[model samples]
Target: MTTLITGATGKTGQRVAHRLQTLDHDVRGVTRHSTPRFDWHDRTTWAGAVDGCESAYLTFQPDLGLPGADEIIGAFAAQAVAAGCTRLVLLSGRGEDGAQRAEQAMTASGAEWTILRSAFFMQNFTEGAFADELAAGSLTMVEHTVAEPFVDADDIAEVAVATLLDKGYVGRVLELTGPQLLTFEEAARAVGGPGVAYLSMPTEDYITVLTEAGLPAADAAGLAYLFEEVLDGRNAYVTQDVETVLGRAARSIDGLAGGEQS
Candidate 1:
């Protein structure tokens, strides 16, 4: 049976697909551009993507915290199960209410599911939304004193691959985090050198900056919400789930910043 991967070209999705392939697992990575053309917004395209797949890795676009995400994810899970894809893995946020709702919906779908409730990704600095700003030598945000134990994307992908292939991890909700917590300013310095500047602005101003920088209005607003509401020190702690799942210590941001990870 095939394993389906949504968001196949995205950060974690790409990594998961590659790792599964390296392990010689049959992988069908689906995106809006794939041969099957799986689109999150277009329910018409879902059946073809889920057909003949025994398992799937789901990473919702925009985010799972958006309104109506629970409904959409629930529907997708039901479709996957009906199509005989019994194993489902979801990429979920750490401390978001909407994410929890989506999780519940997936669980209620009756598929064997594993939820990787992950911390802020370390790759946000190197390869994500903040990459351009960090590359420009300045990173700005709606600054708060809250620290986050940012998990490496590579670690998350490994865990996803493990859980998808191993039924022992079925029905588990693994909270994945790095070994240490770092505030935004500290993270900025770690990613760039000490000369790099970290700037804090009001939430609205930050949203304006992102929109002006060509980010969609909804995406900018979603990012602003995550920074202002979700980054309120609720997820400052680290977890051993990654170590437990992978049988190795989780990668630290320091290692990533030092070019230890390629």
Candidate 2:
């Protein structure tokens, strides 16, 4: 039986799919562009994507933090279970109400489920939203003293693969994070070396900067809210869940930078 991977082209999804393939597991990677297109907005395509798959890794697009994301996730989980998928793993964010709701929805689906409640990804600097600024030798953000225990995408993927294949991890919610916390300025230095500049702006100013750079106004506001509110010291601590699952320490931003900059 094949394992289905939704959002297969995304950061975590792509890593999960590649690792599963490396293990010689049969994987059906689906996106809005795949043979059996799987779109979060289109219910008709879901059944086809879940069909014949014994397990699935679900990554909700835009974000699971959006309103009504739980309903969509709940529906997808139900469909996956009804189609004979016994295992479901969901990628989720920490300390967000919407994410918790989505997790609850997956748990209620009656499938053996594992929720990977992850911290801010270290890859955001290397491959995601902050990549361009970091590459240009400067990074800017809302001014704050809050620190994040950013986890590696590869570590999350390893844990996902473990839970998918091992029934031992069934019904678990793994809180994944790096071994240490770092402020955004510290993170910028780690990724771009000591010469890299870190610029701090007020939350509103940061949102304005984002909007001026072509991000939608609503999207910019959401990002500002995330940095100014959600990330405000609430997630400063580290967790050993990655070490517990992977049998190794979670990769730190400095470690990731070392490897990437080598």
Candidate 3:
């Protein structure tokens, strides 16, 4: 049976596809540029992507926090099921209502589903949105007090691969986080050595920065809201889900600091 991995070129998705291939599973990696052309915006492409795949690793593009994600995810899940994809592992965010709605849709799709509700990714400092900022020797964000348990994309991919292959994880919702929590300042220092500076700006200023960095006004505001609302002492704790699910502790920032990123 083939396992289809959406966002197959992305951080976790790429890692998951490689891991599945090493494990000798039939892996079908789907990207917008793939032969079947699985563009998330084009519903017409979904059936072809799901065709002949017994399981799928579903990572919503941009994010599940974006508008209309629930409908698209729900519809895609239904399409996957109708096309005989029996299992699905959805990569979701920790504290977004939009993410939860998409999770609910996946559960209701009648496919054996596992949800990975992950904390902020460790890759944010290594291979993600903040990588450039950190590399530039200065990391800026909104108010500095909150700590986040930054989960590694590798751990997420491990859990996702296991969920897709193992029947025991069916219908489970695993909340994944790193072994420890760290503030943006600490994370910056860890990722880019002591030379990197961490700057905390006001919400408006941060939004302005994001806008100046090419984010649309609404997108910038949404991120500002996320930083202020979701990251405000809410998801500051750690979880053992990585160990519980994968039989190993989640990778820490220190572990990632010495490794190659996707």
TM-score of each: 0.97, 0.94, 0.95
- For candidate 3, lDDT tens digit of each residue in 1-262? 8999999999899999999999888988999999888988898898889999999999987778767889999999988999999799999988887789989988889999999999988898878889998988999989858899988899999888888888999988889999998888888899899999888988999999999999989888877876777777878888899999888778888978888543
Order the numbered candidates by TM-score, best leading. Answer: 1, 3, 2
In candidate 2, position 68 carries an lDDT of 79
For candidate 3, the lDDT comes to: 0.88
In TM-score terms, candidate 1 sits at 0.97
lDDT of 1 at 5: 98
lDDT for model 2, please.
0.89
Highest TM-score among the candidates is held by which one? Answer: 1
Tell me how far the alpha carbon of residue 159 in candidate 1 is from the true structure, in angstroms, after superposition: 0.6
Model 1, 1-262: lDDT tens digits are 5899999999999999999999999999999999899998899999999989999999998889877899999999998999899899999999998899999999999999999999989999999978988999989989688899999999999999999989999989999999999998888889987888889988999999989999899888887887787788888899999999999999999898988874
Q: CA lDDT of each candidate? A: 0.92, 0.89, 0.88
- Ten residues in sequence with the least summed lDDT for candidate 1: 222-231
lDDT value, residue 233 of candidate 1: 80
Q: Which candidate number maximizes lDDT?
A: 1
